[model samples]
Target chain A: DAGVTQSPTHLIKTRGQQVTLRCSPKSGHDTVSWYQQALGQGPQFIFQYYEEEERQRGNFPDRFSGHQFPNYSSELNVNALLLGDSALYLCASSQTGTGLYNEQFFGPGTRLTVL
Target chain B: DQQVKQNSPSLSVQEGRISILNCDYTNSMFDYFLWYKKYPAEGPTFLISISSIKDKNEDGRFTVFLNKSAKHLSLHIVPSQPGDSAVYFCAASGAWGTDSWGKLQFGAGTQVVVTP
Candidate 1:
């Protein structure tokens, strides 16, 4: 089975500009989560989506938003991007939302560069 | 504030030897711990996990030991190979119920290099 997949392997945007990143969940998975990994740091949770609604979000500001489609694909939109927004955006998928034991499968990630 | 911390930024070990990476957390509420390995330009892959109920968990050549009292956990790799060299991240989550929502908090990560 195919694992999680993300689109726009890399991107470049200027300050104040917006960018949209996409992700396809792994086969047989329904929950999708987005993370931002800054250089020399581990991935930080952005938000999580389940059943087409956002379930949990991290400390990120309102500039960062996400959507989950009926097909279980997800889109992460960053408005008014800042220089700090330049990082690797990773998408992870899990089989269930309620189980604490479920392991998440990650995608290759989309690298975003803000100028 | 960094809830999870990997004090060692990097480590080098000779092939066929044992490699141990350590992690500490300040959040006592974190009960589930996990280790993830990542190569350059790739997302982290799950290595092993241990629940608060158990002090240790082993799978193949990898093992994770959790010391809840000390808020510390470690990943041990035996007979390390060059391919085992990668960045490792420690993650923790509270119980699924309540306000936790199963969110995972991650450490900065440690780079491990196994040389022949």
Candidate 2:
């Protein structure tokens, strides 16, 4: 089975610009979550989408938003991007309520470089 | 505040030796923990996970130990191999019934270098 897949392996945008990264969850998965990994830091939770609605969100600004399609695919949109927005955007998918932890399967991630 | 912290930024070990990676969390609500390994140009892959109910969980050469009282967790790789050389991360989340729904909070990550 194909694992989670993300679009635009890499992206480069200027400040105040907008960017949209796409992600397709793993086969048979229902939930989609987004994370940001900075240099020397672990992946931080951005938000999670279930049933086409955001269930939980992390300490992120309103500039960041996302949507989950009926096919379980997701898109992360960053408006008015800042230099600090440059980081690896990772997309992970998992089934909701699959016991505890709900191990997430991640995609290769989209590297966003804001210059 | 970083709820999960991996103090060790990197670890070096000889092949066929034991490698222990530690992680500590301040959030008592976190009950489920997981370890992930990542290679350059790739995303973190789930290695193993443990719930609050279990103190220890093992799979093949990798084992994870959880200490709820101390709010600490560890991942042990026995007889480490060169291929295991990668960045390892510790993550945790609250159960489903609670407000947290698989929203994992991760550590700074520990890079493991297995030298032959």
Chain B TM-score of all predictions, in order? 0.97, 0.98
Quote model 2's TM-score.
Answer: 0.98
Q: Candidate 2 residues B1-116, lDDT tens each? A: 99999999999999999999999999999979999999999999999999999999999999999999999999999989999999999999987677665889999999999999
lDDT digits (tens) for residues B1-116 of candidate 1: 89999999999999999999999999888878999999998888989999999999999999999999999999999989999999999998777764445577899999999999
DockQ of each: 0.74, 0.82
Give residue B22's error in model 1 in angstroms.
Answer: 0.3
Return the clash pairs for model 1, or none: none
Report the C-alpha lDDT of model 1 over A1-115, residue by residue, as the tens digit. Answer: 8989999999999999999999999998999999999999988989989999998889999999999999999999999999999999999999884466657778999999998
Overall lDDT per candidate, in order of appearance: 0.91, 0.94
What is the lDDT, from 0 to 100, of the residue A96 in candidate 2?
A: 79
- Backbone atom clashes (below 3 Å) for every candidate: 0, 0
